[model samples]
Target: MSTLAGEFKSAYSAGSGDALAAVFTPIGTQNKPYRLQSFYDFTNAASLQKDLSFALFHGKSLKVPRAEQTAWVDIFAAYWEAVGELLKYEQDWPGASLVAIFTAWKKVANALIRGYSSSAGIPAWTLPCLYTVGKYLRTFAINADIKAAPQGASSFGFQDDVAADIEKNAHLEEAARIINRMFTLCLSDRAPMEESRKWGIYQTTNLIFKTYFRINSVGLTKNLLRAINAQSADLPPLEAFPKSHIVTFEYYVGVIHFLDENYAEVREDAFFRVIGLTQLMQAEKHLATAWSMCHRGASKNRELILTYLIPCHLVTTHTLPSDQLLAPFPRLEKLFRPLSNCIRKGDLVGFDKAMSAGEEEFVKRRIYLPLERGRDIALRNLFRKVFIVGGFEEAKEGQTSLRRTRVPVVEFAAALRIGTHATGRTRIDMDEVECLLSNLIYKGLMKGYIARERGIVVLSKNNSAFPGTGV
Candidate 1:
């Protein structure tokens, strides 16, 4: 006990925030010198009180400076109170509720934030301790919400009609409110650059962004962006922060625009060709950077990046993911490879089957609508094949031969029947095929003029008939 107190005092005096944070971090690591288990056995309340007292108030051994003693005492007191409640909750003692557990942890977070904000000489490095406490507060709140929900209810069914679903997620909403406080604190700091709380702004913003997404209040994310933009002149460049912070911030921003269906802008340059909105392209760049930077670890994060990237690529660029691209992620391969095949082959029936098979998973990931739009690309590919099969026109005696740019509606109708796998008894509707062709032309996917009376499509003879495709 004396040795632990001595170590804590030394770390506090030296402003070794990493060491201080590890003391409160719940999970144990092989290299962490002070695990919760090392300090007190949860089974013994007396032992916990004794150890906590020695660390916080044993004047001879702990020796906290007088100026910062109140903040120090309050921080440790809240942490020990939380630890006591956690013990009861873990043991399933009577009346020990998840809400109580979350509340206790929230107090610890509030104490840490207060200390970090009000203390005169607190190092900015201690900010991560606040983040760690805030993170667990969110976790416990989520768990509490799950525990509070009715048995057998689908928590994912969060719609305006279901008042119960909204009520059940109240804890998550509360967590978002507290996290926003942390964000405001970070953003409002006016300290010197090296010791300022502003360094923690993105980290807190990322947490609130995640919470907002979980509660299905994605529109609130825009408020966060606007807040950040308002203070852009004061904040450091995004690149100055850790890669984890920048990557998460970019990812949420990307998904926000993605959900808004704002992928209309496209840009081409010597080094790269981006066929999506400016925000999405920027997101892809950062996600790609995250993938390359953390190649050896963060496998789940890399997979998440691909989860949105694949659909973004398909919708904006009319391109399919390559086999090599999905090779490392077998689950993604199963989910997307069939769609890629169907789109490339213009097999509409097969595409529909693949979509049905993965509909639930796609919808759960929020990529279903964007991917559903790939049907148009599949239709475009089918008609492109009709032009290919039409071949070249016959040459006149004194003239050169030209590629067949005018295709009969009947021929396109035949290809559509094959793509849709129509039965022999099924009638192929030329009008419907013409309607599809007209949409492609209107969307600029194809450069063509439709002749309704002549029942033919006169595609542009210019080299770029299909705008995105290298046809």
Candidate 2:
């Protein structure tokens, strides 16, 4: 007849105070005696351990239907309340309560996810819930570690908990997989690039990138990259995002490639793509800091790299909150950590480590992973012209007025600044641009366009006229 009897009739329930007190203390009683509601709260919280354990181990047999979503929400909410109680008393139980809290948090996460797709079919709110749980887990882990450090205590390994959960559970993987699959399906199938859905997709993808970057498992990184590529065709034009999601993806891909030691790929794909995201970078301070590093490269080759790369770094580090950003990227902090050492010793190795670390972290999180392949295609277009003279010029309509009938090849090094589309017949005498252009022409980056009847010359398209690749 009791409410607890009706609501928590499931075998998973752990019963009331005397029963639970044996396992953990009774902390949530608001009034005199233990009522049905109290029992409901107590039982649900304890049940979280069982729920998560079951989901992690036995998810294969589970089926989450639309009608059960609400039930799951109630189940999760009860657990959430219980966990709050546990945290308040974590000082008392230490390891035991910490483990219990972790287990219960997992259950709440499971319940929320199960409820994500309701009778309405995939509640629009599921993405938010997913991100919230991810953040909560992350925060809880940090807090727990911080609490344990002073006491000389360590257990319930929070990172291991998350890693294991993700590694073991089909549902968590499916949650990530399904969102990625949706993006891929929509993009490849030419499904409408609905703005409404992209926000959620972007956040989820962003989380996946952060997690994999933390683990530094090349296998995970490779898989995430493949997923991004899978949906590349369905992505909206890069022009669709000037500041937010688009720039974020580009920044991640670039840094990931940098870490992977694919320098040429970083240069062609990330460094050159900065023009599109420049507006976004200029407004963000952290971007400016990284941009300073971009300019710190050695030699003309490195200098050329810094042009676009600086922007990518800034976009990655500054655009998102520091907490939400890819701070956990493996070996990333280690790379930057040596900056002080470099400054202290004035050593090249330390300098290189710091520079590469900062730059690579930015590139992976912001440039490479989430970019559509169209971006790759764009990068390739510019890559073809990297060795060509005047190829970096921003040539518009192929001519610089009647006086300058053809886009002239300045020295290659000079062309790096002005781009492939110079407008006037200024009779520039830069030897670097001339040599670069001539070499490119020889190498096929610049095809000679001659009007035989008019005895005039024209510059062929340097792929997309330098707009797409930033050259």
- TM-score of every candidate relative to the true structure: 0.86, 0.38
* 10 residues in a row with least lDDT, candidate 2: 317-326
lDDT of 1 by residue, 1-471 (tens): 343455567777678876776667655467644445444443254465445654566666545555456676567667767766776777788999889988888888887777767753455767777778878877888778878887764553422111224356888788888888889889988888888889999988988887888777888989989999999999999999998888777766767766655324322332222334444555566555655655457666667778878887776577799988889888889989999998998888888889999998787777787788788888888888888878888988998877788888899898877776543425677778888898888667899898888988898774567887766
Each model's Cα RMSD: 5.2, 15.7
Q: Residue by residue across 133-189, what tens digits does model 2's lDDT show? A: 554544444344445445543333312322321223323343344334433322333
Off by over 4 Å in 2: 1-75, 78-82, 85-91, 94-97, 117-122, 141-198, 234-244, 262-471
* Regions of model 1 farther than 4 Å from truth: 1-7, 10-14, 28-65, 119-121, 153-167, 262-296, 396-400, 422-425
Query: Model 1 — TM-score against the truth?
Result: 0.86
**Which candidate number would show the highest lDDT if scored against the true structure?**
1
